[model samples]
Target: MSFRKTGAAILALVMAASLPVAAFAEEEKTIEPTEVTFWHGMSNTQEQVLTELTDRFNEENEYGITVKLVNQGNYGDLSTKLTASAVADELPDLAQAYNNWLTAYTDKIVPLDEFVENDFDDYEDLVEGYRAECEQLGFIGALPFNKSTYVYFYNKTMFDELGLEAPKTWEDMLAVGEKFMEEKEMPAFGVDDLAGFLEASLAQNECEYASDEGALFDNEAGLETLEYIMGLYNNGYARLIGEDDYFSSVISTQRIGGYIGSSTGVSYITADDFELGVAPLPTNKKAAANQAGTNIVMFAQDENQQAATWEYMKYLTSTEATTEWAMKTGYLPVRVSAFESDEYQSFMADDITATAAYSQVDAFFPAAMFEASNAVRTSVNTMFEEVVLDELEPEDALAEFVQIINEECDVE
Candidate 1:
């Protein structure tokens, strides 16, 4: 994929060759400066970095493009506001998006399939898994940004003292966790995001998470994955956030043997007392992890604003910008060049925990995204919790929630 071509490179040049050169070679029109409004949910340091980049682009880009950033609280708040704005036809020029969030309002958003195919050279530099959410739509609906994945972090010092090795597969995880549990009489393993863990596990085991007909997680393969997580919880081999707040906090305080959690979680873990270790998520029948993050999407607007928005969006995913974004924000870079850049390579050299996620980039894939996607995820989470807490039988819970989620997704 070529990234160097400017979006303004002879745009609107679809004249038939039969037309005389005199007709098509008229003087090129000068593009006026355009102000693009962008809505997002980033705050704190992330917001600071974004502001810094936007300010630089506004001041230095050859095209006079100004992007105004609007912080709309968190993602949930932004989603609700977007839907309302969609209804009122008052959407901003660009916004960050999850795959499912745009499915409901596709017409209002510009489909970038033609743009990327015709204008976005260097598309191949992007990680393939990042745009997978739009594969079903048959077009590039969004640009991947701030990508991350589930990673396994363990207490290496404790493992060595206990004569145990970090797990590489689900079977290893079960056996190792149970051995630690038996020895210490405490929970030995856990995951910070159960929903992401479940999704990645299903994919690893070749189970369909959802479809037009609804979820297939109650099937044999899906049940196997679900039960595996439940077994760890039921046998006291795994722990959940519950009343303890964050699992990362307990990782050092409670001395948990290991945990599967957000790839960016390394920054939050306190390693004062132990040698912390990080590794990619353990595999099962398949080696995979859930790719997590939002993508930037442009809403339909006037030609000038659209062009300016494209420049800003392109700048965000460029190799240099994405590499800097990842290093500062702890998110994965969107471009292969960014990932392999000297700056990023140096950062990865000093950070083993980040390597845990980056090493498995090839195995990363986003979960199925469609209408009511988050609803289905919540259903799966509830079902898992019910079974683990002994509030319902696994069979009953799975059967019930699968149907309920299907109805919520309007699958019939």
Candidate 2:
């Protein structure tokens, strides 16, 4: 069967079994609607697409559920506000939350396993890796929302002009950047998130930043990762997009020949003067890319509101909806069914750049999922700045940062 036809068949079966026929028929007689509030960090184009999808769900779903989406600026701001709301007992019915952020409110969030098993027959269709990442403390704490993986975004025109192939490993990446520096007199690579870059690089070297035991990135592999990145910075072959935006460094300045960034950022990367190319991040001991993005968490609400929220959540992650989302934004589809859908295939055919993230899905892994994950990321980022910008020696900087993170993070 065709991908679309298969999805449609499974969806029909799942929806038929989602709610009891007698209960659904009786509920249809109710005149009142269940009002659910959703707080999200989406803005600009992403927010627009989400609003359209949510509106469609509100209108088409069998249940009378009205979702009021409140924009919470960026993810960091949303995290802060959500934490405060949880304390005040004023949390929204649904919110976009990372695993670390969700860990802080375990008591206030509803586990999704019960709803998934009872209400959705196609729950097994969710991508296995995504499902595993969402699982916490024996229950699915959240559902994947706007997931993404890192990819190498390069200026194809520059590479073609120099007769250089895209880098496939860390050593090759530096060599390519050095060649670009010598030939074009500009840095060849820039990274928007140093922390994420470090995580992927460390994974390639079989190292973890931290675990329940403590910090694990202060060893040989970590030192090598730092030294190589700092070498590029010292040689004027690379730059870090600290406070400044990635687009400004790459597009506006035209100085950065390529960058390692989230695939979702593809829409923001403009190459009016050059051909843009997207590839999986370079590997070393192993192929690895950092998996990221928010998940939908349902708060502790009344039974009716909880059911309504689950319906919307399941709808958001449905094959049709996820395919539309991946096509509209450059984010990865959360379900395997979406990947197999004809709609996604057509969209990928038109612009393969957006699908670069999918190519790395099998190799993608999450960072530390504990509450201290954010602190570890901050420490690593600061360590990068100290080594590259402040000229701190790699070994000394790594040691100092590891100590700081261990003290601050209090792992286990």
Candidate 3:
């Protein structure tokens, strides 16, 4: 027990103590599964389906993570909330957004590449054109969800009684409308807004609202599209109807002969005491086109939380999940695997209306935007509204609209 021996014994004891503490620290470092929050714009029937999926995930998943689903109201309201959340550093793990708004939120989002290497793998499972569109959005920007393409919706009972065939070319569509307006005292199409028809017209012509550089909807293709819309006004095939009139007569009880509307409207349209039928959008030539719907995007979150969010997102957009959603809501399944699967085909086979919608899947366009383009579409719509209501000359209105869009859209 001399001084040197005592010092050595004390040093050994200290090292032993440190070894046990370090071991305890290592043992306590197990990674805990993180909870994820999903904010969506779905309401009513759509809301119910989303909730059911989340509940199933919570009940069935092996991971000890909980998913909280929140209804953030409609798209506009949801976008507002999302922006506020980002400002406060309280953004949710996942958010549902349309492409237009998703563009604005790009900086705040977590690139999906962090989890999946090649997004094309996911794309390959979806329709080819749509897959290309998603791939163009850059590394795993969003998961396509809640998709829809526009179609011509007609009342089967009415169409049969009138003996009218579904329109193929734009001329056929107008001819059908002329008969409906003059003889049956019914309009061919009705909607709260005119922009839908304008886009449909552009689709009919194999033209887009914007080019790759982002020109608005007032180019040559745009003007031709507008002219057709003007024809609908002059020919009396349609009327200027708001949401109230649309749901009441043109839609609900099926008083109207035919109308252009979203394919996703299938479930709601069928539920209102009418037998509904769907046809491809009327085209200038014989082909067809319409815009696809929204996608799911993840905002910036911590690493563990980001991983959990993607796990739930994959479930939401998986072939199985999208198939269920397609069946329940009458939405087109975005996944090619889902569309080609027997389960999906069988679901459509049992329902002719859904089947018709399914057949038109080959004609959808990816949603995109143009530079300073707001004025173009809005101007075209305004021209239609004025002409239909007899507020402006069709030629003058369109000419002015084209001029305005061209001026604003010019490259510097």
Candidate 4:
């Protein structure tokens, strides 16, 4: 080492030794100027809002953190890239993540407990369901980004004219469809996600979904869930997106009574000549609905990088930012305060679709995150297709499903 540098280091150490330990300990913490790279898969209006938020943070943050966004296609493309980057230790500082992907790379993720508690002022305002879902590996490893839940969107005018109310149970749904059968001369009920229908229906019927052991939805409740879904399709009462690629297509044609879809479906739907209304999914054994969308996760990095990345994470989830995001995008706000804010209150007053789904946020449930979670989700979709579209017996399809998932998700 250079003599001058060595002498300077020694002198600095001597100076530090002269200060009282208590005084040094009391010094305030500070952040170094940092450039945080964020990876995400948001597109369209979602992408525009994300950029606006990032630009605002870059311009307004006191910590001198410059956040550069890396837009990585859609969620599927993002997941494929993340799988490769994680193994190579080349992950961006932070990225949007699914719990399954986060589970797959738990060792590489940085827990956010410290930041959630110490740096965030609105920690207590976060919705409990999303907060609970973020607790991974016994610590907060991710934060809800663009959350949504299944909601029943109905043509209020037609429902009222037919003397039908928003269904309160599976029985109510089947009974109400009869009225639509008389008028529409077509299937009036639909669900956008059959896999979601299976999972959420199973949970509602008091059946466990899956776990480290194996697939759990092979019991009576599981059979009943499949039978219910099959009956809807076979009876010409309901359809799925897979069946016809329909939802907005049907709604735009004014041929739908109602459908179950993510709250974000509000963006694509218009009631046309009918008055639109949204309501929580009808319940059976429980009022459970499956939550959708992803969260933001940070990778393990140097202390400065971690701190700066965390700061941005905290900002992204703050009440003001989340409220503004929900107003601009169709996503549900993650914070209760954000939803309660006067601006959002006014927004929802006009946007009844959002208001209805927000009422069921407490009922939202997350799927299990395991090594083979993504694969199992695909299998569930296949199971639905086999039973509903291909006319496979529910029990036989379920048996094959259990075997495949047990082999794939059997964790060590």
Best by TM-score: 4
lDDT tens digits, residue span 110-217, model 3 = 877645562224645766555545555576677778877767778766677778888777788788888888778877776544665665567767676554444455
- Looking at candidate 2, the ten consecutive residues that score lowest on lDDT are 24-33
TM-scores, in order shown? 0.88, 0.87, 0.83, 0.89
Ranking by lDDT: 4, 2, 1, 3
Q: Write down the lDDT that model 2 would get.
A: 0.81
Per-residue lDDT, model 1, residue 253, is: 79
Stretches off by above 4 angstroms in model 4 are: 1-27, 242-246, 392-404, 410-412
Task: Order the candidates by TM-score, highest first.
Answer: 4, 1, 2, 3
What would the TM-score be for candidate 4 when compared with the true structure? 0.89
lDDT of every model, 2 decimals: 0.80, 0.81, 0.69, 0.82
Model 2 per-residue lDDT tens digits across residues 163-238: 9888988898889988998899978888878877777777888878776556788788888876776677888778
Candidate 2: how many backbone clashes?
0
**Shift in Å, residue 307, candidate 3:** 1.1
- Give model 1's TM-score versus the native structure: 0.88
Clashes of each: 5, 0, 1, 0
How well does model 1 score by local distance difference test? 0.80
How many residue pairs of model 4 clash at the backbone?
A: 0
User: How much does each candidate deviate from the true structure in C-alpha RMSD?
Assistant: 7.8, 9.8, 5.3, 3.8
Tell me which of candidates 1 and 2 scores higher on TM-score.
Answer: 1
